[model samples]
Target: MAAPGFLEADGRNMSRATVLMLMAPFFALVIFAFLYPLANLLSISVLEPQPTLEHYQRVAENPVYARVLFRTLQIALLVSLLSLALSLPVAVLMANSRGPKAIFLTACILLPFWSSVLVRTAAWAILLQRNGIINQTLQFIGITDEPVRLLYTQGAVVVAMTHVLMPFMVLPIYGALRNIPADYSRAAAICGAGPLRTFWEVTLPLAMPGIIGGFILVFLTALGYFITPALLGSPQEMMIATLISQQMRENLDWPFAAALVGVLTLIVTVITLAFSKVFRFERMLGGRV
Candidate 1:
């Protein structure tokens, strides 16, 4: 008979091989679909036109590109913060409620997802236009003498983006809040802590993982956001994605557009790394280390 140790080793090897075989299709898809396209983008950015760095140099030197990049970061941060603020109360409500109340709240939150993003944005345009419902309501209420220029402004872009992204923030936070044992809060109350104090001290810290995850999700999605900003914002309010689209389509500057993409990709990589280092992402996603 084979030695027990040798038999155990052989079984382990077979298990490892089976796992790898199961994962082969996923790895192949990632390589061809994602890594290959990214490699092409990086190559075109620097290797096109005889290995020149002038494309990147122009992006660095140009004031327009810098402004747009800064604006994109600003808008993304704003949207993330706004989404967090709006989501917290709703998440709390959902976490604490049960039965029909929970169902109703969930339905309200999910109602927006049934529609396309373009349709949602167009709805905002109708509500914010000069003679639209919002302006008319304000006029009827005597808040303003005439129609306000609500559409095609930075505020409009921020508001619409916040509304669109709020669901992403709410769901993560709700999950986090729901996972906390009811005993913890009861323990706090027994320890003479008021409701507000118990929530601030016990509840918030436990729910932080969800909050961070939500913030990162909203911020990253907003960074590459195109349609909402494009429709609602003016030329002066253009974000980096819009600039990249203009460069690619209107100017037909493929290499330059690739360089712009390279810059944005670098920024995203840096931000993701920084967040990972500062927080335990495994915990944030409710996984054990």
Candidate 2:
């Protein structure tokens, strides 16, 4: 038989054990579902064709893969920048407004997310097709006499991607802006800084973390985006993701495909770490503010 104190301790231990047991499924899911596959891909990249470095050497030597990788980074960077430009004003408007107006503005930004990605891409395709509604409307309104080619281009991909990614950019920045004290702006005004100056100096600095976070988020996601670019862009504008799919499916080269995945993973990790380091430095400067 146990003493009263011993019994209570045992009960507490059991309770803690029960909580941990409840969380085991999540741990297992991450380990098996996500981590296992990643490990397999990494191993496959190196171990294929008798554990040689030939695949990586080929990737480095080949201009086609190099070009696709470059194009992917370029497109991703462009999309992120465009998303930032479009999201800042919207986030500011939402962060400042209140009640029904703020709600309406927020809904407008979030409404597109409720729909399917395929649905959104299809809609854009229809709108941008040579004889689609946009061209027809343009002709009707006398913007252009002839239907112009718009369906498959780099610009079309960027526009559709920006539309999809805008909310990711907006929400983080909005949260950052909302957290900033109104007093900062008030003080700026007292110090003789006009609205533009206040924005450029005081507000923008404080909001940098969120803007950086949003940019990184959109930028990284755009890097792996297959469907949007596949649908909206042509072969000349093909991205790394599409190339990876082509390698695995069309070419039936698992080793090379795995190498592509490995390279992409490395690139993403480097970029994310670089951004995280920047964020941490800014936080040090911020100091509990």
User: Best candidate per TM-score, number?
Assistant: 1
TM-score of each: 0.91, 0.88
lDDT of 1 by residue, 1-289 (tens): 6334443455544454556777999999999999899889889989888799999999999998899999999999999999999999999999999999999999999999999999999999999999999999999999999998999999999999999999999988888999999999999999999989999999889999899989998999999999999999998889989998998899999899999999999999999999999888866663322
Residue range with the least summed lDDT across 10 consecutive positions in model 2: 280-289
Clash count (model 2, backbone only): 0
- Compared with the true structure, what per-residue lDDT tens digits does model 2 show for residues 1-289? 6334433454554454555777899999999998899899878879977888889988899998899999999999999999999999999999899999999998998898899888999999999999899999999999999999998999999999999989999988888888889999999999999999999999898888788888888999999998999899898889999888888899999888889988999999999888777676444222234
lDDT of each: 0.91, 0.88
TM-score of model 2 (CA atoms): 0.88
**Candidate 1 residue 180 C-alpha distance from true site, Å:** 0.5
Clashing pairs in 2: none
Model 2 CA lDDT for position 176: 81
Deviation from native of the Cα of residue 89 in model 2, angstroms: 0.2
- Off-target runs (Cα >4 Å) in candidate 1 are 1-22, 286-289
